[model samples]
Target: MVIVKDERMSRKRTYLMCPPERFTVAYAINPWMDTSAPVDVELALKQWQLLRETLARLGHTVHVLPAQDGLPDMVYAANGAFTVDGTAFGARFRYPQRTAEAAAHRAFYEEQGTWAYVEPTEINEGEGDFAYLPDAYGGMILAGYGFRTEAVAHSHAQEALGRPAISLQLVDPRFYHLDVALAALDDGNIAYYPGAFSAGSQRILAQLFPDALLADEADALAFGLNLVSDGRNVVLNAEATGLAAKLTAAGYTPVLVELSELKKGGGSVKCCVAELRP
Candidate 1:
């Protein structure tokens, strides 16, 4: 049976994002990124503008972070912080390449004055490895580890958010971040790639969401699972045809946006977005 919960419809949502001003494939961080691959800076900017316009058109508030000169990966703002109920749990990056972003993100939150920042003790990549489910699941945090985020950070997130955090370990390099492997839909359903997870993690997901929609390798590789959802409307990569069809069949409005230029840096729609809780 489809897990249906009391739909709490909120028309307005605040999203934190950073523009691709300094975006470039300067180094290889993930499997998808290649330093040799050329990135179209102008095209990436246009695509990002379109994404922000799309979100604004959907009746949501978009808060932008000024892209710093040295932090190219800051464009993928979802890695910044995990915000829940006006509290922001800061990120402690695993790689030195991204170490500069932690301070920038914290400063943005501090300047916004919307969320109370909680400094994280362990290495965590923020919302890239963290997701919040619908109220049916008690708005619990689905935390991923074994890549950018350490398992110990789950407790830090749980304590900061005052919500139960379920840990899931990622096994595949391609889906190193939870945002790329799994998406918690607004209607209490989950869309995920089973192969991206460890055997034990897959079992935990199955137990928690029996009727979750599964994505094939093709869809997953297309960054289909990396999407932003407002419970009813889903914004995702335009190339994710199979996943888009599945979302439509499941009664969601799939708004497609092309981010091929940004994908060279191993990011797409959801990667550029950080949901804000007030």
Candidate 2:
């Protein structure tokens, strides 16, 4: 396999994260969530801390968001907003359970004074459904719908970010969020689970990313595709051996992290990470 080199791989990244102080699986939204099961908050906190530390160790700046007491899913900061060039398109959650989160996130963005928050006219789940592709792909935004985010929100995001948007419809209930089924890596590469997307969406992805790496069912089940990349390195679930091997072969270093406790909340690495672009 020939490896493509991206010169902008060394670009520094800024990430926003909330502590898992109020994290828990009290309700079930996606298929991965099971409210009946108990969550280990201690382990969740430890895992989240390790993830934050990992980002810091990788030379990325990590910004902390104060965790509000009633918002259990606030730790999934990626759902807060889709930010680009310091402009934030606030998320409007589809489910009532998460609706309150939108306001809290908007408040945070406004208080930061760093981002110009834009109220979205439609329902969008922030970075959970909208991923920023590399410059190789013309710095396009990959938007997902069919679960949490609405397709119409793509145009709003495009307008806010001043970038083109490609809408991908998710088909599998388990992969409710696009971040769980796909990752936009550096070097114009993408890794995803095809089974999670609709037939038409899969066709679109195939045509657009002919050389995209495919994750097997086992890896997909482990949320292997839910990853964050800094061009040269990818941080993802530790149990996804198949995807790790594939990433390594593609000339990318894979940084495996454990988030089993956090998985009970239907999230992994990317879920807790919100990229701050400028």
Candidate 3:
């Protein structure tokens, strides 16, 4: 007797590219700055440009999207939407102040027709609270359910993606998103700020990936541990001395990047951009 295997199950996933014009969008927030502190506008713009270049250097097609009139923090594009499988799922920001970002995201995806799409009903912000980790058993996407993405919304994302979802608890206000604390390495091992990950989340991570690296509290708060890797090479903040050495010993080469401007705005390199379609 001959047996038939399912061809659909064996197919590989496809990746999409966004041109430079649609990559980043910025909104000036001069008035929002604390007068007590100095505003490094020049430095901020330089770091922002560096973030764009970093994504491009990773071989992603960048698209610098247009910004809305009043949203100053909008330059950190990850807060806008989540895109996967050539489809864009717009977000409904939990904070009322950020609700306007949805409009920009909707407009961008609308122009790109013939793509699968999902419009969020429940409150579900994008990259700020979620990260997709690539692995051999398909891929896993983690959704933080406390600050911005609700538990119910995470369920919706799981259903939408047709893959398993790991729900993470973002108990700390400072770590409003998972990406703010966690980054997945090339080998499916995760590097995260120990203080930022909840006890429950840590248990889950340990169970799923026994080799996960727990970063130091000082380095984590300083955003020294956050990194991006091209599934082979990892780029990190230069100040992550301890973590960098550890990664090197682990057989991964770490490229250090300077991002002083992002620190001024409570953001590191990871928060400033999303590795879209990679």
lDDT of 3 by residue, 1-278 (tens): 22222210211222222222222224322222243455466666665666667656656556666655655556656667776666566789876656887787677667767446678888987766767765724877877777668888878877876656788887766666777678866535677875676899878877887776677776676565556665545667767778777666665666677766555445566655655452
Provide the overall lDDT of each model, using Cα atoms, as 2-decimal numbers. 0.89, 0.88, 0.63
Cα lDDT tens digits for candidate 2, 128-177: 99888756467788899998999999998998888899999998888999
Better of 1 and 2 by lDDT: 1
Instruction: Please count the clashing residue pairs in each candidate, in the order shown.
Output: 0, 0, 12
Clashing residue pairs, backbone N/CA/C < 3 A, model 1: none
The lDDT-based order of candidates, best leading, equals 1, 2, 3
RMSD after CA superposition, every candidate: 2.1, 1.7, 7.5
Clashes of 2: 0
What shift in Å separates residue 272 of candidate 3 from its native position after superposition? 1.9
Model 1: per-residue Cα lDDT over 96-190, one tens digit each: 88899989999988987777999999999999999987474778899999889999999989999998999999999999899999997774668
List the candidate 1 regions with Cα displacement exceeding 4 Å: 1-10
